[model samples]
Target chain A: MSTRWLAQPERGNRRLIRLLTWITLKLGRPVARWLLYPICLYFLLFSGRTQRISREYLQRILKRPAGWRDVFRHYHAFASTIHDRVYLLSGRHRYFDIRIEGASALHAILAQKRGCILLGSHLGSFEVLRAHGLFDQQLPITVIMHEAAASNLNAVLHSLHPEIRDHIIPPGTPDTMLAVKERLDQGEMVGILGDRVFGDEKGMTCDFLGKPRMFPEGPFLLAALLQVPVVLFFGLYQGGRQYDIHFEPLADSIHLDRVRRSETLRPWIERYVSRLEHYCRLYPYNWFNFYDLTDDARPSHTAV
Target chain B: MASSPQLGFTTASGLEQDLAKLIVDSLRLEVAPGDIDPAAPLFGDGLGLDSIDMLEIALAVSKRYAVELRSENRAALASLRALAAHIAQQRTS
Candidate 1:
């Protein structure tokens, strides 16, 4: 159940993905979405590792034994998000119904001309926000992610929307801080996923879903270092083409005295884990970290 | 529990040493307080300290100096020298 599973080359062939992306774009969303059921089944049957990981995750969330159908649904939910990414990246978001809450809080922060951090998790699709025209139309958002993790999938998506490539800030670069600082100074939002720890990335263990798991300290540290407002964002799929996105202020500014570094960071990480757990319960299948949710002190290749 | 404290002049270098001792004690760092370079970065390659360590140092500073070290105040925490300068400014104010 190690994250090593994710680091292994992605299962889908490049040509196959190219073909599927073409079909998805040409057939439109509805017909493309139908392909998810069979694709879900194919993975469920062929990929035992994914099935096992899904069952393990579902067991904890459901608080009971998870059946094959539950795992199938989990795979389907994941595939559905991938399928929908086509439309989202292409600016064809009118096909889906999206509900946004706590948008004023974001507007209020932006009104101050002080850019804030949008901290998201792997629980749901981060694309839902951008697809809704929140970027450029409402405010600018720059995504901070490791470019190498999903190079293949990213290549396809980048090809569809060439402008998005410019907004990405890859981690581990010397100028990463300068780039982010420049963007923030310009009153633009920077989004980062906070749940997983990338390889060699320093992280601390915190209680998550009644167990201890490692959460990356980098995002929180960056937020505190930058001394910007931090907001929690969740983009959830409520089945079909409907998505519910929620935003809540997590911290005004993360300040920790060296002595109380762990003490302060512990509570922040816990609060985030609790919020993630809450959504996982509401939409169990939406939580998609296909690995054992245990303490990963050593960095995972998939995390970045 | 004597209230009266001995008052003496502490030189700039002396104050820096004291601050370094505070950081070492606060973070339980392996290196000796005297080993820390005043001009070297407190983080990254200098002390090999991480973000959490920086936070711990900030907390110690706040408790001992009664001075708030915010994340935005990068100049204050850039290095031991910068931090000492910030502390001196805070004491004067």
Candidate 2:
């Protein structure tokens, strides 16, 4: 994390990206599709941060044998998938085929009026849910992302896209539970990336994509105590302006006696990891958790 | 920033244990006081606490101790040592 983009807004970066996207859209989808190359190459070459992640992920994903080329190709494909998804929403394509398989499970939980916890991972462009053509903005979708200080790219997307801005729920101060609980009480469901290590409580180590990665148990714990069902959704990119969105019921009943609370929460967390695997493996390019998911025997108990 | 030193009360360990109990009760963690080293790291992986639990823990700590625990103060949450130290330092006579 040496080169922090947190330094400056760098408006120039935004302008160039806007210009490129505009030209690509104007020039027809064929050439525009091809344009993903140089953009990906630029990021992959410059963002040593992401490249380093690609190398590590390759180790777990390609258990047998993998070379630099495989990692490079995945990065390029990832970049292209990002570009195309952006293009699809930009009206280059009218609508995508996003099929969410388990709406019944979600609807059932929402019926309780106690609120539901949509535990999501950064598996695919979550925004693709909008492309599903069934998403009603009226549905409160609060996404708890880290406090963003940098990334002009985020600023542009957030400002320009209604779908993006409408759904963002940022938590800065410590009182997240009160806020989330308030929202939940309003008969609304809030989504958080529970898979990521939020600098909160000590996190748990679980198997992810055949490797051990630490995951936060707070979301499930909250869900259980709240006595709500937790359903895992898998957003997969099926290409050609289509997505295979599937939701699986992880736990219909989460309450456990005091003796079984911790023991009970483990499987639900693995359920999250399992769904992340399905989505990430199916749409390998769209999963964006590139952080160093290593357990550094390193003391995490230290203060942040 | 830490203020003038306050000598450890014999009750400091008890206070830490009580604080840890509040944490376990609220977060439903499978941890025992013996498992929580008052001087070791608490959030990363030591106690298997996640970021969300961090927020909840702060709430529990504040609610039980009447101490204002702000997440922004990196120094205040440096580790269990720091948190226990904070709890002890701010304890009212």
Candidate 3:
């Protein structure tokens, strides 16, 4: 697929975002959340492309035609997470009830003293995991992000807790691989969003939600190169100050032999896509890929 | 930056040729080792290589030469000759 998401402009300006964040922080969550209804309605009416994309995704997962209410719910879920980030970043995580399901699996991998990859998607609130790592567990976690895509929004949000700026590693730089290697060697957890493909980076087409969708192979390749275990994480927002964070062990180690590289990587990508589909079906509104996922000029290629 | 003495060269040095072979072998490029000009860029339009190819070559170089490539030394990735020189310098230091 193409980088259509990258081309889409940031929705809101910095001043409005800063104002909203300031209000959310000062007024508390319950009072600020009252604002999301009008905001979601505004997007649902104005942002036609996002509304249509959400309806299409909901139709596929819901196995029926999605109604306006469903689309509104999806927008509300997305806005809620964005609002929660204001609190989560400011180190007020205790305000929400986050239920983590698979701690033992993560602990088992961590006990080995070898760094592991936590593969996540745009399914829900990744900030929940970051907050948990920062506050509850005291784990040194670094997030790999594409900073240029949403520069304005990121700049404003990052200013809330400037320390998070130090933990970010942007992809596609000369230092990207070396920095990841150093962190993995130090036995620190590295988080990567495996769903989105950026620029011309290589990708593999896999069956997702009963459709052939392309997923980035960069995260898996990095895991293979670093020879570390991989774990799947999803932080599903359950509405009104509740999040269900789930983690599942993906692979103890990934070894892609050069000769059969495409064949070897196929099953891993399929497994990841299948798990993502499972969660998307479980929590229908959690998926936040606001663009047409299957629309691409390139032919579907199983090989990366 | 001023044009260095190494610019505009057409042929590969001995170390550059070795690195060219390693890159061609690891990335499975169709180009012959001798055909890869030492001064030509290794990424972008020059060799038509991307960031993924850079990682593969870096891994191969680390395995073969026992030298870790750092981001601060990104200039080494400009061409075959520069990388070979960087590796050689790093080995002695």
Candidate 4:
């Protein structure tokens, strides 16, 4: 799979990011959000690659040619989520109308004291879920991520809420799986974004949004190894201070036979991609992967 | 410690050899089992293994020896010899 996404540089520098953060915190959200319009306009005019990608993705999912306004709205949705992160991280969730669906099912799984994997994508705001973990039921959610992917942005965001640093588990470290296993053993929820492929990790190509897209196999492999239930979550930005967090049960346990590893994993990935597609169609503007997902040169392998 | 009846002369002990083979097989490493240094690190520069390999080794060890490896016991993953000792100690305990 193409690793182009990894090489994509952070747009703004640290000084600019810190300045924005400072403004967002000092001026309050209402005054701070006005800054996004100019910022979005700057990106739309200057970031040719991202703008083209946004247009293409919107067209594919919308089933119609995306005009400049559609692309602008897409960028605005993304910027809104990023802006909300400051409030969510600073414990100001009351400012927004956050509605949660299928939360009772999640509570039931947690009540069993057997931790499950909360698999998410780049669809919407993950910070909303973090807010839920922080204020709501006090759900112990640890995020597994590739830290080096967006170091500049992360550095700025981490500074906003220093406490969140403790909750992140970067993959590829020797202690990564052990840490994840320990957390699961303690009945703590582990959150992983399974849409993007990183490094040389194996990826399985599945039909998504009318084309084959490669998804990292590492998350599913970890789930199979840990023998835990898997749950799907999507924190969709419903525009104008409204965020809908949805959770659904995915698998009781993913068992991959050694002989038929890819075959067993196929259905799981397909189910995930289909659910992601359903949501993307439902809320077309909420998709946040800013790169060409279906442009992989790797030959698609059918399950044996 | 000198020799084993099942296999011919070998430098590593039976447990260490078993663990080494398990590591090579599970990770599908091109190196031979005997080539791996028992005292060298299993991850990073030594074996060039990553977190995924660690989990793969852990799964293999649990299935073969029925000993569970935990994050708290990170020292056990220091080297092949250390891992073998940890497994033997756990099995006995």
Candidate 5:
């Protein structure tokens, strides 16, 4: 049902969402924490399938005995994270406290005036990038993502935030490839969600946590072709409306033979997995990936 | 049929036997290495593995073989045999 809202015409809700973003900006985050309860309830009551899937992932990934309390905590935290991400895009980071560790490293890369690939995962609010984007006015960021298959709420946000929607590149097709290449040639950075599966075989086999998972190699492969430095980025939600942004240099732009270039990608994948593992260990609730696609029993598009 | 490492085998064949054990343990498969006829299929006929299962196997092979599987190297036809050759090369190198 919510999927219908995603494809709904945006004109009617444009004003409403703009007003919501303003109200969110004004009210501040402490007052914002109150919204978590009802949002938590909505997931518990409304999304029977999603809640079950999350629980299953938590159970397998955690790989230890977890009581109902632990399970409920994950439910509450997941709900809370979603609510916070909404506030974040509306300028919550400025008013609320955010600890950023590696902005300078990114700035240094941007200073080079060469293209860069910034990789971030779904462990926290990728929206934090919007704050940096709007503030720094640095190189433009092209984000590669799967087109949302559901969630009208996300659709509304995307449409309202044209900055986000326009910059996001959906999987497949040569057009997006040309766009990314264009951005690279112009000395801009491209961002990608390296964790999710596009279900294509065009990804590298990676050991995520202790298990082997298929992670997209598109960004790294792109970096090699364009001869750009690949920088790894982490934006994690800290407690109480706060986030910590970290950046690491995966590799310097270097001339490489074909074989050397592909092997070069290994360190970048290792760095991303290492950083992602840290966040996952601390905030198990916030890593919202449904690892086993089989458990994703969300009502199908045909069913809707 | 795999030339049995259980009795005695060629060195390259031994590497193949070891890789089979690594795959079974890493994926926690129900079948043993010797039980998995190297010529037998990995998908519907033999082990009934899917792509997801293949990914799991690929990761295990990458780690133990000290070889990285790149984006271009993925194809269903390049299943156990391709993986065995990759491991053999990595071991020799």
Candidate 6:
């Protein structure tokens, strides 16, 4: 059970990503999106791991035997989200019709003059949230990411639009906490992907879907220490040029005492996992953790 | 800038030792306070700690020193020497 998502080889290179970006911008979305079918087919035929993982995820979410078509749809959804990123990155959000659910809750949070942790997952287009940032000047958003994975593609994306690169806070660096803290101090939004744990990072086993899966303790711990409000953001790919951006408040404030910090944090994590599961049901093809998430046999103690 | 110099205990080595003890007790590590190298990394290969441990240390520091260590304090968190210095400088007590 390879729980490590970062260890997996990058699917596309810098050249491919740049080419897709160029073609998408030059040819426009509709024609560029037609290219996703062949790309999805390429993965469906060649990437056996992606196919099997897609089936595994689809089976659990769909609650039925997932067939090749379902897997294809899953791949297509992922590819489409990636394609939309080209537009989103370039500040061309007019192409997609994004309906933001819970805008009131978001506005209310922003009303309070405190920074927040925008906990996002890989379920949908995170770029969609950034797209919202482009239009809305009030919501200053920054993403916390592991820059090592897909360095080449990230470099390409950064080169295309340096503003996107400016908003990134890479984890594990000495300045990561400083960057997060500085942004939060300015009453700005700091986004972090709560789904995937990196190599040797401490994680906690929680009931996700129906089985126990390891969820990284880092993000939750950061929230707890900072004692800030946390909001769950999910941008689901509805299909074609439509998306649903959902924002729900996960916690008013995360405070874990030293005595039973682990015990206290467990419920908060479970609630988050349950919400993620609920969203996965709504958009069955959106959940994209490609690793063996159901592998409960991995010793829980290995996290630290 | 560390402004809390009124506590009067100004020895850097002494503060480092105190922080080492605090870390061990807070994280429940098996190592003795003296065993922790002041210059060694608190994360990854040195102490083999993760974000949770770091947060634990932060919480403990906050409670003990009445200092809220924000993310901007990350540079000062890299080693025990640095963290101890930051805590001493920031400690309201």
Question: Against the true structure, whose TM-score is highest?
Answer: 3
Which has the higher lDDT value, candidate number 1 or candidate number 6?
Answer: 6
Output the number of the DockQ-best candidate: 4
> Evaluated on chain B only, what is the TM-score of candidate 2?
0.75
Q: How well is candidate 3 docked (DockQ)?
A: 0.38
Question: What value does DockQ give for candidate 5?
Answer: 0.02
The DockQ of predicted model 1 stands at 0.08
Query: All models, DockQ values?
Result: 0.08, 0.11, 0.38, 0.50, 0.02, 0.36
lDDT of 3 by residue, A140-208 (tens): 788887552356556777787787866777776655767777788888898988887766667898878
A39-96 per-residue lDDT for model 1 (tens digits) = 7766766777767767888898899999999988887887787778878888877778
Tell me what TM-score chain A of model 3 achieves: 0.93
Instruction: Write one digit per residue (lDDT tens) for candidate 6, span B1-93.
Output: 133434455688987887788889878899999999999989878898765567667767767666777666777778998888887767644
Q: For every candidate, what share of the true interface contacts is present?
A: 0.03, 0.13, 0.33, 0.56, 0.00, 0.26
Q: lDDT per residue, candidate 1, B12-77, as tens digits?
A: 787689789888886678888899999998766777765446665775676777676764576776
lDDT of 4 by residue, A1-304 (tens): 1112112324346677778889999999889999989877776677777778788889898889999899889988988888888788888888899899988999899888889899999899888998779766578898986452356666777677787877788776677888888888899999988787765567888887878888877778888978888999999999988999999999888998876787888889889998999999998999887757666643221100
Candidate 4 Cα errors over 4 Å, as ranges: A1-11, A146-150, A297-304, B1-12, B24-32, B35-50, B63-68, B72-82, B85-93
Please identify model 1 stretches exceeding 4 Å from their true place: A1-11, A133-136, A148-150, A295-299, B1-93
| Model 5: lDDT of residue A79 | 52
Q: Deviation in angstroms for A42 in model 2?
A: 2.7
Note the Cα lDDT for every prediction shown.
Answer: 0.74, 0.61, 0.79, 0.80, 0.59, 0.76
Off by over 4 Å in 2: A1-12, A24-30, A44-49, A84-94, A130-135, A147-150, A162-166, A256-261, A295-304, B1-93
Q: After superposition, how far is residue A117 of candidate 5 from its true place, in Å?
A: 0.6
Candidate 6 docks at the CAPRI level of acceptable
Scoring the B chain of model 6 against the true B chain gives a TM-score of 0.84
Q: What DockQ score does model 4 reach against the true complex?
A: 0.50
